[model samples]
Target: MRKYFHIDLNDRSIETQTLSGEALARAGRHFIAKTLLENDVATVDPLSPDNPLIFSAGPFAGSNFSNGNRLSVGCKSPLTGGIKEANTGGTFGFALGQLELSGLTLYGASDEWVVIRITKEHEITFESAEPYMGLGNFEASRLLHEKYGDKISLALCGPVGEYLGLTSGIAFTDPEQRPVRLAARGGVGAVMGAKKVKAIVVDRHKMPPFTDRKKLMGSIKQYGKLLREQPVIENFGKLGTAMVGDYTNTIGGMPVRNFSSGQIQDPKDGPLQVGGQFIAELNAGRGGETTHACMPGCMIKCSNVYVDEQGEEICSPLEYETIGLMGTNCGLTHPDQIARVNHIANDLGVDSIEVGAMIGVLMEAGVGDFGDEGFIKDVLTEMHKGSEKGRLYAQGTERVGKHFGVKRIPVIKKQALSAYDPRVIEVTGVTMMLTAQGADHTAGNMHSIVCDDKTTEEVTELSMGAQKNSAAADSLGLCVFGRSVTEANSELIVEAINAAYGCELDPSFVLETGLETLKMEHEFNLQAGFVTEDDQLPDFFYNEALAPSHKTARHSAQAVNEVRSAHF
Candidate 1:
């Protein structure tokens, strides 16, 4: 049986060690659920003040499975007044797994700023974070590398987080000590800032491997072979996530001009429709670099290092969401500009999606003309300088709308919607609104729903299923990409788990676990003061008809109400 040590940062204290077994399973569920509820209640209570954030990993985290490296960072989102779990890839999972720590629950605000370091040699130390304030991720990373060396992985927040910017993100160092990976959603960085934690560095030196090595390795080999044989996985390994840009544009699902249209004629979509345009453009001139992996021993290298005109490395892996939000939505077709923006966001420790959405909203409000790269760059410069306008942009879309006195803002629950338009891809929009995390595409990302007809009922059904599936994937510490193969026979995932853990379990139990987690989060939000009104999209989406496609938001208030009713 696996043992877990629950660390409560509420009083900078530790709880008694807990063991995970059949006897404690129900107790574990209740304990976690109660912890979550207490945090939610405290967030609203006048007497007891606390801001809680939970970091959790499943038992399968350190296993050899291809997608088992996921880590979840959950908190009440600064952007959205509900539960938010920003999942990401990093060595933290393997490190935590090696430490046999299932979850780290942090609560209460610190009087003085601090940084926590967990070394692989079973050493935990807390240090002052005063000197690290106002440092960008690149500079902070350099400082940590100089002190901790390349073997240790660090998760750090930058000046944006220090300033309590709602869109700020946490940056985690890769194995190379580059601040490349991110827990870059739902403004968890702001929550960390509020807690006065500048960084969490994990050092897993000389830690032994997982317990069930033989069974884990066998399952990993089987899944790795299955992934290698799949054509989609192979293409992902080759082209990386940016390969979806062209397909999204071609299918009229790409968000263009603040999602007013989906049809965009941007060269960023791999040039004009010449045959093999994607391949040809990739081959021409140092643009399309070789795909690479984010972590050690990752077989599907679905990431790339993008370069600019001067052969300078611009960014690591220009993705579809960045392209859609920064490229087409902002009316800028230059991949170099997009890459630069991504780099800027990374350095500033802000969410690229929110920044791009803010820029798009600004353009829509006529503050800057669409496609005006110079103005866009100027706004970004202001953000870098921490000016008033920069602060406004950093606060995000709904706040921007309030500041500018504009009601036509594209947001849900004060969070900006992502790159997919609701009209063309209705299911994702529904999920964006209904998810505990507001306006986050990744909260559900109902791409599978695009296969079905976009009727109101079908859209609702697909959104619900996608939400459940996403919850399951996240809880299992598996990448959603693996869902392409595993989603159909989800039972196979349970079988793999059973084989690795030497436990007999039915697959339905996995789904049940996910559903329970989702329900817990939702209940927490309800107690935190979220309402049915929060579960609806911004008013503009329904009233305004997006151009080119000529499709208005089809779901009515009643329809949206019905969807939320079903879920609740």
Candidate 2:
């Protein structure tokens, strides 16, 4: 059995609920959606005290299950005005699993900012957060560690989140004590900030008991073995996610110069500097880790620690999205430049994709020159200082575009579109248009699909399949990068879950759970007054033809919604 805590911040009261079998096994994203629906969270103001922030852990958490220790943070988004589940790879879920806790929900607003600490004994206490306020994630985490100890994992609301920046995300500690891993997207950090919670500290303990320890261990080994034999997994282990940029750029699917062009540099230029191959080689030569795990026991280590020419750390993970939107989209080609900005964004606990898109739009509005490092640095500085202009910039891409009267804004449902150029990445485009999760690719990304001969309905079907798989993975606290193996071997995964929790779920349970979660989210969005038109790509995508590919968005919101309705 696992304990779920309902913490009311109004009077600092805690209520615990015990869950077992299927309930505990299928937690994380599903739990958040179900709980919110039951609590009528859809009708509440997203930033109000009534809006609960949920944190959930999967059943395989704290075990040596690869990509199985992710933590899901969910709330009604202040940015998108809809359901948001932003999961991150980190030790927070592992710590919860160690303590035999499934999840926790925070209700009501605190009278003062506080650091909520959970001890090994499950004792929850609130401490003054004055000392950590206005500090960057690095300094704040250091102070938290000094006061608490090293054997605890932290979830921090950064300086940007202190004043409820819409681009802010809650930062979680990576294995190396770096708070670069974030539950990033949909203004989750703003929700945390609204609750007046500065941080969440959980004490680490030994792994919790499993129902069938020997069988679970065997399943873990089998899963790892399967992942090892997969060629795609091997490539990811070598190059990390930056390789996606290479493929996207080559195929004219990468967003370049504020989504004006699909490709950044011409092929005549030497190797694409911002792409994964170049970055891996560069980082490796500079004594940096080209492949590293975001969480403990992740065999497919697709994260990295990028460094400067001096062999000093710039950022822990210089990912493909940051490379596409922040590097190429902004007309900056150097990884070092992107890494410096990435470090600053991480320090602020803001979503780099949103921040990057915002900067790109600012450039589009003639506020700054594209590829100007000085302009980018100045914007980040203003954000850090929480100046009036900085706060305006922090409102995110869509709002900033509106303020500047920019017509070429790339956003859906009020949130900025991710690195993928929907015009060229057609199936992913369909997914972005259909998902209630705003313009998030992780909701369902099918960028690898060859869409030249495909129909809108066909692409929507493909998107639905991918979305189901992704939803299942998110609900299970599994990383989507492991989908190649996990989706192909659902039986093995279900068997592992059964061995761990003694549940008798069928192989089809994974997709079914995903479908259910999607339905719940869709229903929540409807209740929140989201219309079919809200699920659309911007007009620029339909009217403007991207260079190289010269493809405009082919799917309409109505057609995509019809297909989705048929599926449901």
Candidate 3:
């Protein structure tokens, strides 16, 4: 029998249940399906669902592998009126896995403020936390560390979430209790705040070994070997994802100044200067300190703890998304400034991508001139103060556009696009339009598909394939980084599953689950009153002519409309 605990946040209660083999299998599939379904249903509701957040760590989470540490957060995105699931690399996945918990479902509103602490041996406890109000993630982490000592892993939110900002996100503490890792997107932090729960403290003291330990270890060893042998995996570990920043900028794929241009002036002959510069500076100061693993048994320590000029820690894994959105897109030339912006976003609990895009739009509207570091700092300072202008900015791009009457806003389904410029990489635009989760790049980043194609038909087909593959990756709790080398090798994943569960499952089932999840989310959105018209970019993108590369939007309404028909 498999044990599971269902906690009700409203009354601070818990229900324990055990399931047979058949029941466990069914529940696993249902839980995965329902996560996609519930968010879809909530998308069309006028007031939105109260505290509907689903956090699921996969069956392979605790295993020793390069990519085993991934967790999924599903909720109705305030940024996009569709289901959104943002996955992150952090210790929370491994901790949850050790506790043998399949997932956590948070629902309903709470009357009194509290924080829930769960452990392998101790019963769930809802403790009053009135003293910790209006604290940022760092301070919150300090308080939790004081109480729980150094062993506990925490999932926390900050004042931004408390204010119910649309771009709020949940922050996960590193092993050292620094609030650096984040399941940070789609306003999930707000959902936690709505439940009147400030944080989730997971203590896995003396947790028992997972069932089928021998098989699990064997599969983990096999996959770990494969990951080690893979060239891309090796490269990613060494350089991380920002290695692509120079490449994207060179190809005119990097969105700059709110997609006003794709290419920026390269100080070097190649576009490698920006990425190389950041890597050099980071390494020079705190490069070799410790490339820490987000989860306990992870081998791919792609995450890093970056320190600033004073040798004080600033952020972790200063990633491509943050650099792209905050650095290039916002017209900031310096990486340190970008890092500071990233730190501010983390402290505020808002999505950095959305905030970057929001600030870009503000620059476009003369709220602050592009590349004005002083003005940018002032705006962020105001936001921290919760000023009226700050509140408007905190609402994200679509809401800000609506409030300010800016017709040139770049968004699809009410959410701003990420760092990639769709005009240069056309297939990703298709994914952004058709995905049930609005304009999320990860929903189906078709960049690789476009790279592999020689013709338009080939591009379309490969993009569709990549989209399906991404969905499958999400369903299986495997990082897309792992998928880059594996491609659609379902058998390899199935082998891992068989090793973990002592049962045979065709890897193709993962693809089916992905499709099923997508369909369920789509149906829920339709029921929630989201129409075909809602799946579109703003008209300004069509008419505006972006400079530098001098590229204008070429996708017609017919072409954009074809995305829904092709995918759905």
The candidate maximizing lDDT is 2
For candidate 3, write residues 254-343 as lDDT tens digits: 878877887655635643544644564465566433355666666665655667767776776577778787777889766677777778
- The true-versus-predicted C-alpha distance at residue 336 of model 1, in Å, is 0.7
lDDT of 2 at 417: 86
Candidate 1 residues lying further than 4 Å off, grouped into runs, are 1-11, 19-35, 41-49, 206-211, 266-284, 448-454, 500-502, 560-568
TM-score of 3: 0.91
Model 3: runs farther than 4 Å from truth?
19-40, 43-51, 206-208, 267-273, 276-282, 285-292, 448-457, 555-568
Q: How many pairs of residues collide in model 2?
A: 0
Candidate 2 Cα RMSD after full superposition onto the native fold (Å): 0.8
lDDT of 1 by residue, 1-568 (tens): 4444445455667553554532222222223444667654425531122556666665565555776666777666778766677877767765666566565666677677788887755466778987777777888878877877776767787777776788887887654566867777778888788877888877654433443567767777877877788897887877677666666676667777888777676445455331123422543467555576665556777767777656568777577787788777888776766777778777887787887888888988889988777777787777767788887788887888777776667788777788888877788888887777778877578653563455777787777777777777787777777767657656667666666555567878666665676677778778778877777777777777766556667775467658656765
**How well does each candidate superpose onto the true structure, as a TM-score?**
0.90, 0.99, 0.91
* CA lDDT of each prediction against the hidden true structure: 0.69, 0.92, 0.67
Output candidate 3 Cα RMSD: 2.9
lDDT of 3 at 529: 66
